[model samples]
Target chain A: MARAKKPKLAVWKFASCDGCQLSLLDCEDELLAVAANVDIAHFPEATRAVIAGPYDLSLVEGSITTPDDAERIHKIRRRSKRLITIGACATAGGIQALRNFARIDDYINYVYARPEYIDTLAKSTPIHDHVWVDFELRGCPIDRFQLVEVINAFLNERRPNIPRYSQCVECKRSGAVCVMVSRGTLCLGPVTQAGCGNLCPPLGRGCYGCFGPMEAPNTMSLAGWFREKDTSADAVRDLFRTFNAGAAPFRKESEAHEQR
Target chain B: MKPAGSTDPLPAIIDKGGLQVLIDALIGGGFTVIAPRLTDGVIALDTITSVDHLPAGATDEQEAGYYRVHDGGGGRLFDYATTPQGWKRYLYPPEERLWQAKREGAGFAIVEERAPVPRYAFLGVRACDLRAIGILDAVFDHGRSAEPRYVARRDQALIIGVNCTRAGSTCFCTSMGTGPAVGTGADLVLTEFGDDAAPALLVEARSPAGRKVFARLGGRQAAAEDIEAADAAVAKAATMVTRHMATDAAAILKRNLEHREWAKVAQRCLGCANCTLVCPTCFCGSVEDTTDLTGATAARWRRWDSCFTSDFSYIHGGSIRRSGASRYRQWMTHKLSHWWQQFGSSGCVGCGRCITWCPVGIDITEQVRRIKDSEGGPH
Candidate 1:
């Protein structure tokens, strides 16, 4: 029997850390197995060998923070069949999305001595905001096991099993006592999505909302409890102003707290 | 005070040696004993073959949204507080494959994924956790579709409940009418007490299996003084718990449907779902069917799901409960009120996992108080 042609997998980056793409490279044990299954098309972080698109699976990292990034994503989307966005930046507009709340121009003027040279957009956005996204893997840096799962699911034409539930579930599974319950520490595990495998809770620290809000998150009730701890409204606002601040639910909640 | 559970057959004195004998009996008879072990700086429930594997000298300090473990310097075994991992993890895992389908020739063949549930003899289960398992049992058993895996795992598992001699700062199982003492839903319940020099356990067997296991250990029959000591320990635990749910929970949650407290909470909530996930009895979940990109093979699996997510209530025409207020209201109301009508008991065992795991320290008792205060409900 003739061997079937392998699907070309391309990884692209935009205006953030290369962590998500590095997550793919970090799959050391599985990298060889993954390479055998698919063609490494245009992962600049891994190799300079670039294969032209019309690729099968395109994994996108980082947020669309620049005007060039906004236009480039559409072209990438057009050339790919299944385009999956990875990490907080590509799925929910990353930490840089804080600009969505404040003025980006002010940041450009303050950071860059030559303010006229800046080519960034007013607001950082996810790939889905500009172009169609087949799937979005939510995380700050993204989970490696999930990255493998997502690729495997897509290659098999199956829906990804990445849960939309909160990190509290993961915390329980991993056997980390509730930092909130045990130490009176503030954690974001309750309403945040599960992907990181209860990382922050085991360390006796709270989840910083790295995976974004879970399904139908009830932030109002949780925030009221936060206020009970003598936390001011500004502190509450800053809490929501995190890795996934531009995500709609988080953004809306932050905006609501801003009024106070 | 309120009808404390009656532990029959009286208790037997099981010193350190007797406990080891009991562990040896379980191990020899094909039971995988699981106990709390200090791993990665946390006291986690992990596999143990010997009594020596149990966490010793370590004590946990727990508060709202916070937990810390410090060495208390020797002797007692079950001296720690609650673990982040619960029995639900073993019985109803975070991820379990349901079935898989593959393309072969003209038609696709499907295969059901099955694995034999292990016989686990759980050591150091707190009263709240034991009650939680009971609540979970009712949920899985009473549902139209019983979780066969949960049923199998639960039925085969042996429970060893540990009475709380010292409560964590966040503990309130006493207030919820759940704990502070080893009561029900276990094969054996042990109350740790006596002088530090002669550390002892007052062991009570709830079932025939428990008695058989206990009898094999060759422990001396407990005297009246041992029972008295156990009672004193329970009484001390009940009074020691400082955290209390001051409000009438059911009444407050039921009446405050559209309270302003919901809005205030939503602002800081972040809807993280930690509370529900940490909760021992929260059994809500969703399934997913997946395959590689080729459309060649497909597999279905179930994972734990929480109502605190935006996608939890999502339908074809967007989300049913879009606002954070509605999601928060749904979770608390369901846990406190809806669970009673659905099952025969409240979903919460008041393990305080939700409060401790909550990154922002969103105390469940505090939220209930707010609702109670806003409506001027009974204290």
Candidate 2:
């Protein structure tokens, strides 16, 4: 098999805190190894020297909030052979998608003094909601280890070894006694996917669903459990409306409780 | 415990001073003594250097979904039953690199890597966990897929069980028929007796290794009353286990396969796998293999997996257990029914870790009771 000179990797950003991009940088030990084997094509966060791509692998971060971003992602989708969306922003609609619950005009008028100047879409949407994605990495700030795994999988033409189970798996492996049980704290590790290793549970706080819902999550059952913990209907609704609330599973669970 | 036909070693009285002598002797003999200690807000099994480091007067209050460690205001070692983590974590790690590969000429060369075994002396190991360690030994060491790492750890480690005087709110060890007393797994059994203000321990050797260690400690010979107090302590603990689940789970669940109550229980299930993860006997794991960016280096990793996930039962077409109801049924059925058929014993040791650690407070005992009350239940 004839291989093209080292695979060209491009990183793109849209509407996000750049926390996901920072995770790629945070891979200090593996960065030198990656730099020698792969070409850093079009990463604004890492370099201003942009090597225009017909890239082999592209990592897209952040949600599509603005109309310009919505159009720009389609172009990126066309340029890259395999595009993987990283973090909650690029996979789900992200925390900013809280605006999806209300009218965009109402949000702009309330937050910005000059509402007329704001140019944005009605809903903060994910890349898959617009264009096709080869893979999606789910996390508020994607796990660095998973980022490495995704890159490795792309190079080898294989599926990324990512877990579709809940955060409880990692918590248990770490020998973390359940905070919900040991401290009476409400945690979302039960329904949330396993990606973020340093979740709030082991740190004396409950999981706030930082990672999106696990594959085929049973939100209804989890909600019932929450209700049994004496959590108010309003509180449960508010929780589901937080990060990744625009995702269908979480959205449905939140909307079901809106009646109360 | 001592083998059959072996002479029973004389029981001895280990006062507060004698207990310290035992700890020092174990450490001096190149063994790390792990005991229950208060750290942060939880009582975890931690390596202890001194008797003061132990959770002497500290005991935890356990409920369906709540646990809180509180100080008992006096030094009374072995007064508390702590940690459901068991001895599994040290032996069977949560995540471990199984093998590493590097490019050699054209083909990759893989080399297996095993962690060096650490000799440990487990202190204050309750009877329930002693039973759990035995169950794990049967699963990993004697199974078709033998794990040498787990067996190595088991062989190197020393068990010192403490008899339980009281049971946790979630405990049902009596129903599981594995607790209230340490029988055959421990090397040495320690029973803290006498008044709380002035406490003493009765130390009995169950193995030759324990007898040698006990000979070093300056404990006096135990009297007949000392033995009676120890037996009475175990009896009281058996009575304290109010939560009951019929052990005939295989019989009850097999008849109730089509029951509607499964859906009712599923309504409160999260499919989080928290129950399985925290369970002492739930051993299901998946292996992962990947190469680095250069394709020159590769590593194989093993991580603990849970059956609650959709991917756990995946086949060529799709996941067999798609709905939450199906996943919950499969897990409960496997633990209670299939395990007995396969291992000649129930998977559950009834330590109550699964119930207490579950995020939503779903009680296993309650589910078992509901099934037994159904039409399919045995009369």
Candidate 3:
């Protein structure tokens, strides 16, 4: 469907690092072109200038951590024609979702002086868990190039060219030597979705799975290999329990090792 | 040194020092000299201007899902087996812009990409890689619709093939009928001996361009003993490769379409597309057309793609190969069975790159053998 003459684009935040929103501002040159095509109606990160809703497109960042965020997402979803979630926070509940596995009351008492004053949910959840999300752009602080592509795709009414395969494809394409194979480093590249331009492998380190689990990830198979390499069950559990811990595949995999 | 005009006949012997002379002449001839260099803990093909740039005395031990570089290899430059990357990176790049368009008054003006192609002199190309290049040649340079970008680069490229003295654990070139020795398509071929021997190279000029570069070296004619040593070194490499691919792989794979082994292998396959990306002959690419935010300018780009992805088989309804089992079957079947029908040759060059680079070490050779053994045939 053709959008308005100049679609009103809104950027919304919940509970996040704000790095994913900064990625849009980090678009540097492309941001200017994006502004010319769409009305930046509400982007608190870039500007305080607010244009009232019924926004054509809304770029949502962060997870639903508080009671207010859980209720606020429903109202935002109703006002926007299309909504896309950006980064690990909005897509997989971010690193904060580690609390989902444990008692939040203990954490509140441990950190905050008065536990009675704290107002939060038991579990941090992705935007899709609260409201319908059109698309989810993955990454810890979503890839800026992909952010531009997602916006461009929405503007042109086309599917965004984001790959659902593992990061190994990008690693091999960039001619980066397989760090796991060469150095025996425990890598999440085989199960992590392709994007982030293969940031870690070439630098002699393993992928922390910032982009989250790839489509139909065989996490048990990879964790089995990790165990074969003498990686402790606890270490294997901690590996999957990272930035994309709340992602289903990673969450299920991490929970499997918890009993051990 | 002899003058550049002097004609040196085929089959000459040159010490290790003469290699530097060859590299110098190729660079002076205005060609980007690419050779095997140690980079990122693996032997990679990159631009080198001198002999010292080669991964001398360094050899890598390779197996399924393993690779490690070790020092103290008798100081032989071409001692290493296959490099992590092939010459396809230079000939058919991973990504290239096809064309661009700009918004005009009422219509858009299409602009053709006119980037200059560089003439390359590829040093230390292995037999498997040379065959891989030939396979790519059929796919891109001499196919129904020849790719202009590949043609422009391949036509002007210089190939310097090197005979392997030692094969890696993953190597199966002999079974594929591709190598261990330089066979065809190279302008110049060199067979190197270890330090215990003369520590020299038996060089042969296979083409006129090879002779032109050979003449500049002014090397002595190779003696009969030197040729014998070179032949012995190549023969030893053939013996080094313990792994073998069944010669009738195409027939075996075509017959076992519904083999149970596919599902078993898919469990470990990861469907990561690493095997396809690391493969030299696995030439599949996808085109993406993108526009600036303002929609004022648009460009088309072709980048490497693999069959292992769900998107690769996505049609109007949905992806054809949805399961990992189906995708794995498609990749193997296409590589062995379909490739023979489409191109007159087998797609795999027995380079073992797919096996070596796979994260899970899902061996293609072992997988083929399992399928072959299931029929209870004496393969």
Candidate 4:
């Protein structure tokens, strides 16, 4: 008999809209190619088929927003050989981290009919906050191509080719008219990470930081440009506090905006 | 051989009706030809046949928060300014099917469909619109890893860019260093000098693919005077544009995130998401699944979504931007300030679609001017 395959892939979710995991399914043509290489032991969103682990790779999505989820992730971490967090929710606490700045109880009361029935944590936190993440794929929904690239890298034992630079690199390469300079339009391409491929700029719009902050982002200087363009500090603060609001640099910048 | 920027004129002139024959030739060669047609009170990219279908003698008056039609003196057919829709509908698409899945006996089987090939000829494309397409190509086609879907369409399509003889009030491509004149990235570029001057087209072949399309046209090479006329036409259009935004806006916006004036702009913003929907490059989307009655089969779809939506930023139990002010701030700053950090340039192309399509008519340029004029933040 042929020897059983060793590598097992597991997908887990927490508090999210499921957009990130959908990105895995969005791989469409790439899905079968990926599954052929590895044993998809667990992916509840894609299939009901479950294979028990210790799995070789685990792709985690969403954020830790409930007490139960917080405890459950630990067991997953122990069972997984390599754990990677995917999307804004899992890596940056998601847009739900907005609760960190405001009153969580007010949200509970406003959204839910019976606040008592809903068991939740005070603030949404990233998987990295709880356990070590081998890698973190940024974006509200990680770009499907990048998702494939990450999976391929891990399978081949190599580093992923994800860029750490800002959207500016993409914009210049595409020869886009500088929205801010030419049109005096407000945009976030200068400080946000390059992944969404400068989607907003050519549409005559700005970047919304869906992919989160880049490595050592010069957000302060970019914020200065926003001001010079007549963007208010509060407006700039709000920009930082979006999508990947809980990310460290964005969080710090947003907090500073709130202080003013 | 003419240099890339030589002011040489062309000898041959096609009759106004000859354009139909040209389009027919393209279609005959198995190309899906798309051009601007008057639709629902706006010029949009739609399928067209003869020159009559074109928005002949139509012009547009575009300003911050305003766009209206103007009569184009009954001579030029492709005289209208750009509409709310950009070429993204063809390149990026509003929604796409990433894959399809079906339940197997024990698990699930999935089939990924081949990306659609866009073997179409885009006619009457404006200089600004061409610039916008170039920007998208950078993001979608020429990247270290091109989006397979975008690449398929981009590789197969042909572009026929038109020089703008009229400028809208919101037009600022001249300031942004993009164009009022046609630039590279086009297969064939036409500059209309009206009937008497034999409407000349200064064709530049950027790629072999472009050369093939131009070679098929059978038009003679341009002369010095024809080249000069095209140049004069572009310069005239550039002068007619009324709007102007600061050049150093990125640096200024980057520093003023905490300024209070955002609150003022927020007051006028309705959060209806008109600006984002009409934007050519706003590619943010959401995913959905529709299942049959048995629930065994489902089709997952990617739909256009906006950050302005309340649920867009929702994580577990709540949303990040709870107020109209925060959402507006998020949209504007991302477009102007943070886009540079992410893509290496500002995201906006100065087409003014957002300004015109916005129901509330919130002028982004005006908002920036207000923020810059205020003294609360560090300049």
User: What are the TM values for chain B, all candidates?
Assistant: 0.94, 0.95, 0.96, 0.90
Better of 2 and 4 by DockQ: 2
Among all candidates shown, the one with the greatest TM-score: 3
- Candidate 3, B1-379: lDDT as tens digits: 1225535464888876798889989999999999999998888999998788888888899988889999855668887788887888899899999999998978999999999999999999899999999999999976579999999999999999999999999999999999998878888898888464337888888778998898888679888777878889999999999899987889999988998899898788788888898899988999988887666788999999989988889889999999999999999988978899999989999999999988778888899988888899465
lDDT of 2 by residue, A1-260 (tens): 22467889999998998999889999999887677767899999999998987998899999999989989999999999999999888888899999888898999999999998999999999999999998999888888989988887877777788888888777888877777777767677788888887567778888888788887677887777778779888888887877788888898889888863
**Once superposed on the true structure, which residue ranges of model 3 sit more than 4 Å away at CA?**
A1-5, B1-8, B194-198
Stretches of candidate 4 above 4 Å error? A1-260, B1-12, B142-145, B195-202, B375-379
True contacts kept of 1: 0.72
lDDT of 3 by residue, A186-223 (tens): 99999999889789998989989999999868788888
Q: Rank the candidate models, highest lDDT first.
A: 3, 2, 1, 4
Across B1-379, the per-residue lDDT of candidate 4 in tens digits comes to 2455644333344556557767887888788888988764556678887777877767766655455566656657767677657787787766677777787867878868776486888987887788777767766765576778877888878888887877877677776667787777877667777453235445555556665655566666667777677778778988987776667667667778877877776655545455776676676777755443233455666656677766678788888887767888888888778887877777777777777655345777777877787744554
The lDDT per prediction is: 0.81, 0.83, 0.89, 0.74
Estimate TM-scores for all models. Answer: 0.80, 0.95, 0.96, 0.58
Docking quality of model 3: it rates as medium
Docking class of 2: medium
**Model 2, stretches more than 4 Å misplaced?**
A1-4, B1-6, B376-379
Q: What TM-score number comes out for model 4?
A: 0.58
What is the Cα-based lDDT of residue A257 in candidate 2? 86
lDDT of model 2, residue B91? 67
Candidate 4 scores an fnat of 0.00
Worst 10 residues of 1 chain A by lDDT: A173-182
Interface RMSD of each: 4.5, 2.7, 3.1, 15.1
